[model samples]
Structures are given as structure tokens and as C-alpha cells.
Target: MNDEIGRRLREAAEAHQPDRDRMLARVHRGMAGTAVPRRSSGIARSWPKVVLAGSAAAGILAVAGLAVAGSVQTTPAHPDSETTLTVPSPSETPATHSPGTTGGTPPPAPGHPNRTTTARPPAGTPTPAAPAGRRVSEGPLSAQGAIDPHSTVYWAQATLTLDVAEPLTAFTVEVRVTQNGGVQSTGQWQTGPAGDFTVTAQESDGAVVYRWELKPGRTVPAARHTFAVQYNHTAGARNADADGYRVQATASDGIHTVQGGFTPAG
Candidate 1:
């Protein structure tokens, strides 16, 4: 029994010897001031991985927020699919007209004929009347004049006196002589007189005709004969009844005809 007990005790001491040695080595290392390595726990080993995963998630969230903000800034506030925009052409503008004028007619285009515009006359305007013909003389001859007849054995002579207030440029005279209740002769004369007398006798319409014309600046003073004429008989012989001789004379100033007559005593 004692021998067996000793063997068991020895075995137990052998087992405890390794533990003691390990404890002594730790104590020595502490005294020498050397670092001791520690065994890591499961939570400590996985801590770095957890931190990386959380950082990645935060980065993803930040990127997504930046994208959303950019989209909001660029997009239209009131976007609609049916909206439309238009631009005008240069030729579509309107034209302007002048003032104080009715928009009657537009100007003609280039390379085309120009159009004429007529103005309208005012209302209630009257047209002019034509001049009259056959006016009477307003002269001194109309107030005073005479024709006298005289007889010779074979011829008859007559004298004419005309008084005028204005200048005369032309004149005509017609005379008829009668004796013994019968027509003897008729005469007409036309001449240009310049302080002189022109006597002429001819036959027309079965009677004698005479005419005369006065020059420029031929005027009569008040109550004076400025024109005179003496006509000689050239038609034929005179009648025996000298007391029965009569003379009719007509004178004109182109616009009027005046008449006077007288009988002569032998």
C-alpha cells in the first residue's frame, strides 16, 4: 500500500510542474518590462469589417442625395407634355400708313406701273356762263349823227357826219337815195381813215353799196363831228323832183348798227 501511494503522488506532481513553470515565465517577463501578446476575442476581430460596411453604406447615401439634388436643379418647375413654342418670320410684320389721308389706295409694288389718284372738287361750285353777242354801242355816235342828200342835173351827192365819244378802228355805212317816190340808188363803203375821208360807190342787190374803216386813235370831242364823208353819184341821172330826194344811212361799230335819214331841198 505505501509503494502504490508513492507512485500516484509522483504522477500528480508531474502534472502540476508545467503550470508552475508557465506562471514563473510571465512574472519574469513583467519584471523585464517586455510587451506581452494578448489573444483577440471574436468581437474584436470583426470590428474593422463592420466599420468598412457602415462607411460604404454612408457613401452610397451621400452619392444618392447629390444625384437627387442635381436632378431637381436642372429640371423645369412646371413641365407639361402639351406645351409649344413659336418664332415669327421677318416678312410677317404689319405696314404703317401716313396721317391726314384716308387709306384709299396702297402704294404700288416694285417693277409695276404707278397708279394715278384724282382729287375731288368741292361741292356747290358754279360753272361760268358764255359771253353775249350783238351788243349796242355806248358811244357818242348813238346820241348824235346825220345824213344829208343833195341833187345836181345828172348826179346826186350825199354827206355824212358822225360824232363819237371813243376811238373807232372800223366802220360800215349803208345808204339809199329816193326821188319822186322811186328808189334811185344804194351804197355801202369800208375804209381805214386817219384824219381823212374815203368815198366809194358800188351796186349790190340792185342798189348802190358803200363801206368805210377808221384808223386807231380816231376820237370825237364832245358835241363835234370827227367823221365826215361826201359821196358822188355814179349810178345814173337824177330825177327832176329835187325837193323829193331822200337819204337813209346806217352805220356800225362792228357790234352795233345805227340809222339816220334826211331830205334835201333843191
Candidate 2:
């Protein structure tokens, strides 16, 4: 039986001829079918279309990512139009307007002034009255007369100023105050030495005549001299308009004589 089986196996092996090329082709097809699936005919023929579709999908995804990034970069969180506030400095502020000030400039402080003012005496205070008439000049002597402002309502003084241009060998000054209402000589004086002059005051010819004569041998140098005659008057402002003075002097040049009247005063 073993011999018969061996002969039958040998006969069967010899009868089936070994086709090596067909067997190799069969093995390659089996390996392709099991390890890697065989593509369909339509898939193999449209491979370019499949690859194109995949590339188009990747481009769309890249474009979408770029668009998202561009939106994030371009879009602003806040609006373009913004509000700005401006504050004024203290110096730029406008000044308040005031009366008597021009162009908005403030006026000088109170009790302060840009210009000076002439001070004047208060009301009821006495002011010296200026001479009413022109000065009297004769030869080397000139005389001006005015009423003393220091006089009151009941008393007054007549003043005489003498400008002597040369030394006087003889000099005599007389002030006559007319008795406007009630006038009487109270006293008399001179700017020269009292001992060098002889003063005599008396009422004569409806007036109080005050005379000052240089004493004998007494010299009066070239200078200015003042002579005043004080008197009592009525209980009101005295009318010195009628009052007059006379100055006579004998100098080296010649005899000088000047006469003038005082201004009215109280």
C-alpha cells in the first residue's frame, strides 16, 4: 500500500506541471489585494480630480485663517472719533469788567493814584488873599501890599513888602487902613531892627495910620523889608480895598517913593 501511495503522489506531482510565472503573478495579486486594497477603476482614472479637490480644500482653510487674522488686525476696539477736553490756564481766564476801567484792565487800588493831586485847605480854613492891585515901583524901591490871612473877623493886619535896591540914608514906611466900619490901630511891626525904627500908630483922617521911620543916623542896607500894621475892625470881614501903604527912601541913586493898597480880607 505504501508503494502504491508513493507512486500515486509522484504520478500526480508529475502530471501537474509547475507554472512559475503564473504562480508569481497569483502571489503578487494576493499580496496587493490583502496588504493594500485595490482601488476602483473610477478612482484610479480620476486621481487628478481627487488631488485637485484636496488642494482646494486646504487653500480654502488657509484663506479662512488669513481672513480671520486680517479681521483681528484691522478691526479696532474703540471708535475712530474721540472726544478731547481743553482746560484753560489761570492766566488765560478773562478778567471781570469794572466801571472807569478801559479794555478790561483793572483800575488802580483805592487810596492809590497814578497822578498827584494838589492839596487844599479844608473848608472854613483861611487862605491868604492875593494882591489885588499891581505892585508899586519908584526909583530904587518897589512895594507890594496884602492883608494878612491870620486876621479874624474882628481883627486884621495890613502887610507891606519893600525891596530896596540901594542903601537908604533916610527911610519911612506908612500903612493907612481906612476905617471901613470900625478900625483902630492895635500894634505895628517891621522886619528891621525895632530899635533902629520909630513906630507911631494913630487914627487920623477917618483911617488908622501906622508909620515906621528909620531912627536918625541908622542906615538901611540894600535888602527887602516887611512892615505890618495890626488893627481891630468891625465884627465881620474887613474891606481892605481902600487900605494903602507908602514907602519913601533916600538912597545914593535918588529918592524912591512907592504906594500901593492891600487886598481885602477878614
Candidate 3:
């Protein structure tokens, strides 16, 4: 009976014994697991906030850089503070015209034949109406002065026609051109024989004078004759209103004198 009681007490004490090593192992494992998650969760939450802040700063920098680049593109290379720059577009650009081409025809190209070019005169200086075939008569001489039809803007020719009803023993013809802006004589000619006349050109009293006179003992038979004078002028249609011509002759009937002024030709 003593042995049985001792064996039962031993079995009960073994069953109630505490497992200290197993409990200590479980507690250490639980603490390690909880500590790792706390550190990992803290890093995860802060990483997103840092990324978001960095993205916002990058966007602001990009916008500022674009604004600076735009400013550089619009500014002038050399700026003048007192002047304003106006850049004309292709559609609004102005056309260019040649100098000395106002109110007159442009000069012909090289090697081109001469032609009659007409245009309207400038404002405030109207072109005069041309007269008909009118003649000024003095005794037996009938004379007329006219501007040539082929006159150009830079040059002009004036013609004087004389009709003699009788034989002439002495004759003289003269043409006077006023100095209306750079007028200068170029040449003169007549329909009569060149050796039978004495021709001269001179400047006097603000005019260019061209004269043709019959040589000594030279006789002019009753006929019609034409005389012409050419000169250069300003680059525009010249006004012949101040130009004139005169003729004197000793005919069979009497000494006759005639004078006239130039009229624009058709």
C-alpha cells in the first residue's frame, strides 16, 4: 500500500509541471514578428508622402522653366528702349517703286527701241489742251511752233514750220526755250541745205536760243520748210507754254516777221 501511494503522487506532480523553455521560445518569436511589422509599416507610409511631394516640386519646376524659355523667344536681340519695333508680316509688306519714276513712264530696257510713253501729270500741275493746226501770219510769212509727238520725259523736240508765198532773199529763224528746270540744248536741224545756212546755239537771258540764217547771197525759192530743236529737261512731261519761235524774211513783196509759241502735239 505505501508503494502505490508514492507512485500516484509522482504521476500527479509530473502532469502539473510548467513548460518554461517552450513558453520562452513562443514569447520571443511573437515579439520579433510585431517589431518587424512596425518598422516596415512606418517606412511604407513615409515613402508615399515623399514621392508625392517630389512629383509636385518637379511639376512646378517644369512650368517655371517653360515660362522662362517663352520669355527668351519673344525678346528682341538688340532692344532699344526708346523705339518700338514693328514686324510687318508678309501680307502687309509694301511694294517698292524706282526713283524718279513718279508721274512718268519708266525708262525702256537696254537695246529697246524708243517709244511714246504717256502718263497723267502730277497733281496741281495739269496738262494743257493741245491746239489745232493754227498759223501765225505776218505779211507773206505764215509760221507755227509745236512740240513733237515723240517727245519723252527726259528729252523734248520743238518744231517750227514756215510757209513762204514768195521768193526770199534774206531769212532768219530763231527758237527760244526757257530754263524750266535743267533745260539744255542737244541739237538743231532744218529742212534746207546745210551749207546754205549759218546755224548757231547760245544761252542768254535764262533761255536757250537756236538760230538758222541764210548765208550771204543765198536765195530761198518759194517753198515750205521745217526747223527743229532738241533739248534735255527734268524727268517729267515738260510744259512748252513758255517756249516760242520767230522768223524774219525779205520776200519779193516786203520784209515780213512772224512769231509763235509751241503747242503740245498729239
Model 2, residue 90: distance off in Å is 57
lDDT of 2 by residue, 1-266 (tens): 44444455445543543444664565556555653445544445555575566566656655655454444433335757878898997789974433223332222212212212212223553222222444499788888788877766666767788888878999877777887776765666667777787666656677766767788999998899887777666655556777787777898877877777886653
lDDT (Cα, tens digit) per residue for candidate 3, span 17-126:
34446645655555567658776576556655655665666556555554444444333357556867999987898644343445554333222122112222234532
20: Cα error in model 1, Å: 99
Cα deviation of 238 in candidate 1 (Å)?
A: 4.9
Best by TM-score: 3
lDDT (CA) for every model shown? 0.37, 0.65, 0.69
Residues 1-266, model 1: lDDT tens digits? 44444445445433332234554455555545643333234334544565566556656655555454444433335755685676666577544333333334432212212211112223442221111222223443552223433443223435444445544444434443422322333332212232432334333344333333343345323343322222333233434222111111222444444454433423
Residue pairs with colliding backbones in model 2 are none
Clashes of 2: 0
Compare the candidates by lDDT and give the number of the best one: 3
Estimate candidate 2's alpha-carbon lDDT, on a 0 to 1 scale.
0.65
Global fold similarity of model 2 (TM-score):
0.48
